[model samples]
Target: MLEFDFCSTVSSIFSTPFSLGMFTEPLMLLAETAPPEVVAGDLAEPSEESLFSVGGILTLGMLIVLQAVLGFDNLLYISIESKRVEESKQSMVRKWGIGLAIVFRIILLYVVVKVIALLQEPFLNLISHPLEVHLSGHSLIVIGGGAFILWTAIKEIYHLLAVSDLGEEGDKGEKGNSVTKAISLIVTMNLVFSFDSILSAMALTKSLEIMATAVILSGVLMIWLADHVAEFLKKNRMYEVLGLFILFIVGVMLVSEGGHLAKIQLFGYHVEAMQKSTFYFVLAVLIIVDVVQGRYQKKLLARQAKLRLAEQPSA
Candidate 1:
């Protein structure tokens, strides 16, 4: 039977030799102040104590809410990516993509829990007069994912502008590789978006089961919401532009976060991560502007139609 030592477990979960030593003293102080049973290793077994408790359940709820809040951009990406395939296969792609991603996310959570310190260790360092970057696994993954999303958004927006007939283009869907490609992209980006959420959950508690449960529940919610969002975009084609721009903002947020994580400096200027509050503020403004402009455009067209009717001779 495996023995459970509370102090050691907390220490291992939060820090390794390679990690910054900021947590070591605080953790030691906590261990010193804890009850004799907790500090002297006289506690109940791990299975009994950690699996389901008031604290664990409360942490679980917090994790679920965190996953949902962070997953909004990811959900948007899935909705838009699924639309590229045939109408019949789009739903399958979403279900399969998220299903596979859920399995992989659990796997990723396990792996990250084990080697989180290694992931944060700086593996690539570039120092020059003009550029300076300290790249780690986490930063590289986020930066790469952000760049891909940015490229996809720009390409899709360009296609929207270049196409002569929007309705005709919407009717024609891609065949052959579209379904496979869409699913692959959806799963990949889903993992990218999961990193920060997983790390945040880790900060709350060290229970793998609790975190995994939250992830599964959040993924289930996403699967249910995916189709509705896609259908909405389909019915209101004008909002597609709004959706794509939101995606663009998401990309920017990810890239900035990665740069901040890596402590990147270009031309002697540091890169800072965009705050979540700022991102949401900008998003709300964008949505309000889009809605107001759409309504104003409709009213203008209505007025034009009325004037033209009045100018015509009575029939």
Candidate 2:
């Protein structure tokens, strides 16, 4: 007869080399200060006796910091996407959309684990070149998420360039866009942004409690800050277009990454790939150039103003 035990099951879920490496030193200290069982079962949940273990507190802090780092890009994207709606409604949209999308994020976490297990099967065949790609769960997610972001970026760019005014007067073209339509677009894109975040959290731990707490806390923080970000973009209107273009670049990067994950190839080159470090390096150079150009332009304007004032006095 075969028998299963709770300790073995718990160990199988939480006992990993990486987890041990992260917790081992702190756990040793914790063991000396507190009971060994308490240190080991730090995450087992809030019991009456020990709801504030040192290990649990450290783990929560790390998760919060990680979530903050990951959520920065998403927050930027949210602020940019919410520009189409009325100024009064933009903050509400971001707050609610992000909060709702997290529910979907938790559901996707479970789905990805099952899908990754069957990722070896080839799902699509391209052509006579005999190149094939697996349409696994992650592939679909990457592709869908990428395509959605790309579409949003393109649409926003088009609206910026093609339309002279973005105020209510210019919304005649969107006369058919009901409140429902606007909210749907906002919510849809929120999910797209959540895709990478949820997948990243999955790699950290299979503990649903950890993932849920991180996401919930992050969502709350995002909601709190969404309005301020929206207001900042409004005040610094010059960079709105630049910000949208950055989002477009991010979308392209996502598509490239998705292609790489699915082993996609085009003309004998991997389609979905970019060195992240290189991308950031190039972006930094571009930002420096932009700053320099802005300073030079400002000085030129000041000099022109001085010359005009002198000429007027002489006249």
Candidate 3:
């Protein structure tokens, strides 16, 4: 009879460095000692499936949909930013900006896959009675991007409010933005927007090819849609305010997300991330209100015109 000391065997198993062999050793030993009539089947190593497999294809489709849903604010930003450039070059800016962003996004996806842990490691620690913030690389980037976007939205809103003459505003608009500067801003913000989608994609699948494909396809869609969105905004100028306010909300959402990631505490209160559902709900309310207000204003103007015509002498 072959007697085995279970405690010693377990101790030896743990003492050795972990490997596939460690798992197989016990099983092999069992097979060797078992009756001759009993036989063990060969263990085969796992192989990676091709990217075109059913699972991979499904993941790719899901990732593309995720990109589109997350890219709404990004698309809005691109449309508005492109308009800042010369009208003739606006389309070019959008295309080039999105094109460059696609390349950078792939690069970023690679980097994140390689050094995700490094990005999450907390680098900044500030603790005080009134304020507390533990910021990582990811959080800092998100917070900075959020701050810049908030500032831009607020500045534009102020400009709109300060404009007393439509003609002067039109002249200012005609001055336009430097093509390089506009494209630079669009590309930079596009990356900021990409972070969320990239992180979400990482959660979905580990395949870089799938994520990159989604990013490229989404960028092409944005380029194609950019002109239509900008033209709509141009034709319906009143909706510009609605767009700006939407951007303001996006900035707020980003700031809150960053704060949550950093575990920030202000005045002893913890900062929490804003839910996406809340954001969409607010957006829907804003759109509904805008549509209602526009129709109401048109009706009021028509009624006033009828009143004026009634008061005028017959002609």
Question: Highest TM-score: which candidate?
Answer: 1
For model 2, how does the per-residue alpha-carbon lDDT over 1-315 read when each residue is reduced to its tens digit? 111232443465466554322322232222223332332233233332221455444445555655665465577777776665665666667777787777776675555445534432446655535465655555666677777878978887787678767674334333334445556766666666665555444433335566677777887888888788777767766566666766776777777767876778656766645544444555566667777877898999999999998889554
Please give the TM-score that candidate 1 achieves against the real structure: 0.84
Error of 3 at 191 (Å): 0.6
Itemize residue pairs with steric clashes in candidate 1. none
Candidate 1 lDDT over 1-315, as tens digits, reads 223354464466456553222232233234223332332232222434354887677667766776877788899999988987888899899999999999999999878756666777789999998899999998999999999999989988998899898778889843445778889999999999998787666555556788899999999999999999999998999999999999999999889989987989999999987766677778889999999999999999999999999999998
Estimate TM-scores for all models.
0.84, 0.73, 0.83
Cα deviation of 186, candidate 1, in Å: 0.9
Question: What TM-score does model 3 achieve against the real structure?
Answer: 0.83
State in Å the error of residue 105, model 1. Answer: 0.5
- What shift in Å separates residue 134 of candidate 3 from its native position after superposition? 0.4
> Any runs in candidate 2 off by more than 4 Å, and if so which?
1-53, 118-122, 165-177, 313-315
Show the lowest summed lDDT stretch of 10 residues, model 3: 38-47
